[model samples]
Target: MAEALLTLAGVHTHIGQYHILQGVDLEVREGELTALLGRNGAGKTTTLRTIMGLWKASQGRLRFEGRDIAALATPEIARAGVAYVPESMAVFSDLTVRENLVLGARQGRLDSARLEWILGFLPALGKFWNHQAGNLSGGQKQMLAIARAIVEPRRLLLVDEPTKGLAPAIVQSLLAAFRELKATGTTILLVEQNVSFVKRLGDRVAVMDDGRIVHAGPMPDFAADRALQMRLLGLAMEAHT
Candidate 1:
C-alpha cells in the first residue's frame, strides 16, 4: 500500500486546559479527496488547524510526506509543500486578484500554465483579475483563496469550510473547481458541514465529533447506510430528500 500523504496518530490538544482534540487519528492518502464532516464545534476546524501547526499538539505524532513535522512552525510547514485555505477565505483585501495569485506562488514567478488552468476552473476570477479581492462576492473570495493555494507547488491542500455562506449556484461552481483540482493531481482534505456536497466529491468520509474521528469509510458506504447518516451526521434521509 502507498504511504499516507498526511498522518496524525493519537493527537491531543487543549486551549487553557479545555481539551479540544483528544486522541484524534487520521490518515490522508495522496491524490484523494477526503472530507472531514461534523456538526458545529465538533473540532473539524481544529483538526485542520492542528495539522497546519496553527495550534500546537499537546501530545501526538504528525507526519507529512514521510517526515515528522509535529514540531515545525506554520511557515515551515507551508514551505514544505502544504497549503491552507482557512474558513475565512484569507485573501488580501486591498490586493488585486492578480497580485493575490502572485503572492501565493512563493517561488517568485507564477506558473503560467497552472495559473491558466486554475483560472479556467474559476472563470469569475479571470474576469476580475485586476479588481481588488475585497470587492468580490463571498463565493468569489473562496475561489480566489483556493486558486492561490494551487498556483504554487503544493503537495497537499487543506481547506476549511469552502462553501460556508455561498448560494447553491456558487457552491456548485466551487465543487466543480475541486474536481478540476483533483484531476490535476492535487490532494485535498476538506472540512465541510455540507453533507450532500461532500458526498458528491469525497472519495472517503471521516466523521468527527467532540474532537475525534468516530467513523470513516468510502463515500458509497455512508450513502447507502441511512442509519449511519442519522447517528453520525444527525440527518435523516427525509431532511435531504
Candidate 2:
C-alpha cells in the first residue's frame, strides 16, 4: 500500500454552540484519490475545513507529511503544500483569471510550464484567461477554482463537491482534469456526493454519517456492493450523476 500523505485521527470540531465533528478519522494516501462520501450534514465539508485549519479541530489530530497541522493557520496549511477548493467555487470575483492564478502561486510567480500543463486538461481556463472570474459561468468559475489550486505543486488537494450543480458535460471535463492530476501523482481527498464522478476516479472510499466515518475501504469494493451503499448513504450510488 502507498504511504499516507494526510491523516486525521479522532478529529472533532465545534461551531460556537454545537459539535459538528465527533471523533472523525480519515486517511488520504499519497498519489491516490480518496472519496469522502456521505449525505448532507454528515460533516463532509467540516472535515475538509478542519483539515485545512479553516475550522479548528476541538479535539484529535491532523497530520500532513507526518507533521501535526491541527493548530496551523489556513495560510500556513497552504504553505505546507496543501490546497483547498471549497464547494462554493470561491474564485476572486474581482480579479481576472490571470491574476487569480498568480495569487494561487505561492512563490509569487506562475510557472509557465505548469500553467500550460494545467491548461492542457482545462482548456476553458485558457479561453477565459483575461476575463474577470465573476463574469464566467458557473462551470467556468469551477474550472478557474480548480486551476488556481493546481497553479503550483501541492502535496494534497482537498476539494468539496467539484461537480455539484454542473452540467454533465462540465462534469466530464472535471473528471478529465482530475485524471490528469492523478497521473501526475497528486494526492487528493475529495468530498463529493456525486458517486458517478468518484466511482470512476476514486481509489479508496470512506462513508460518513452523523459526523463519523461509518464505512471505508477500497472504492471498487464499496461501489460494487449496492447494499452497503444503501445502508451507509441511504441511497444508491447509481442514483447520483
Candidate 3:
C-alpha cells in the first residue's frame, strides 16, 4: 500500500454560520487518484477548499507528508507543492493562454520544456496560445485552467468537478491528461460527478454526504456495487454514466 500523501481526520468547516463539513475524514494515497463522490450539496467542494486552506477548518487535523497544514494560508499551501483547480474553470479571462500559464509558474519564469509537455495532450491551448482566454470556448478554458495548475511541479492536486458541463470528447481528453499526470506520479484527489470518469481513473474512492465522508474504499468494489451507489449517491452508478 502507498503512503498517504494527504490526510484529514475529523475535519470540520464552517461557512458564515453554516456548518458545511462535520467530522470529515479522508486519506489520499500517494501516486494514486482518489475520487471524491457525492450528490449535490454534499460538501465535496468544501473538502477540497479546506484542504487548500481557501476555507479554514474549524477543527481537525490536515496533514501533508506528515506535516500539519491545517493553519497554512492559501499561498503557503501553494508554496508547499499543493495546487487546486476549481470547478468554476477560473481561467484569467483577460489574459492570453501563454500569459495565464506564465502566472501559474511560482518561480517567476516559465519553463519551455514543461509548457511543451502540457501542450502535448491539451493541444487546444496550443491553438490559442496568443489569443485572449475569454474568447476560448468552455472546454478550451478548462484545459487552460488545468494546464496552469501543472505549469510547475506540484506534490498534490485538489480538483473539484472538473468534468462538469464538458462534452464527451473533452471529458476523454481530461481523462487522458489525468492518466498522464498519474503516470508521472502526481497524487490527485478529484471531486467529480461524472461516474464514468471516476470509474475509469480512480484508484481509491470516497463518498461524501452532508459535510462528511460516508463511505470509502477501493474503486473497483465501489464501482461494482450498484446498491451501495444508489444508497450513498442517490443515483445508480449506471444511471449517472
Task: Assess every candidate by TM-score.
Answer: 0.96, 0.98, 0.98
Pick out the ten consecutive residues of candidate 2 with the lowest summed lDDT: 232-241
Clashing pairs in 3: none
Q: How high is the CA lDDT of each candidate model?
A: 0.90, 0.93, 0.93
Clashing pairs for predicted structure model 2, backbone only: none
Off by over 4 Å in 3: none
Tens digit per residue, CA lDDT, model 1, 1-241: 4458999999998978789999899999898889999889999888999989999999999999989888999999999999999999999999999999999988889898888888888999999999999999999999999999889769999999999999999998998999988887788999988888888888878989998999987878887899999999899534652
- Model 1 TM-score, all chains together: 0.96
Q: How does residue 3 of candidate 3 score in lDDT?
A: 100
Q: What ranges in model 2 sit over 4 Å off? A: none
30: Cα error in model 3, Å: 0.4
Q: Which ten residues in a row have the lowest lDDT in candidate 1?
A: 232-241
lDDT of 3 by residue, 1-241 (tens): 9999999999999999999999999999999999999989999999999999999999999999999999999999999999999999899999999999999997899999998899999999998999999999998999998999999999998888888999999999999999999899999999999988999999999999999999999999998999998899877777757
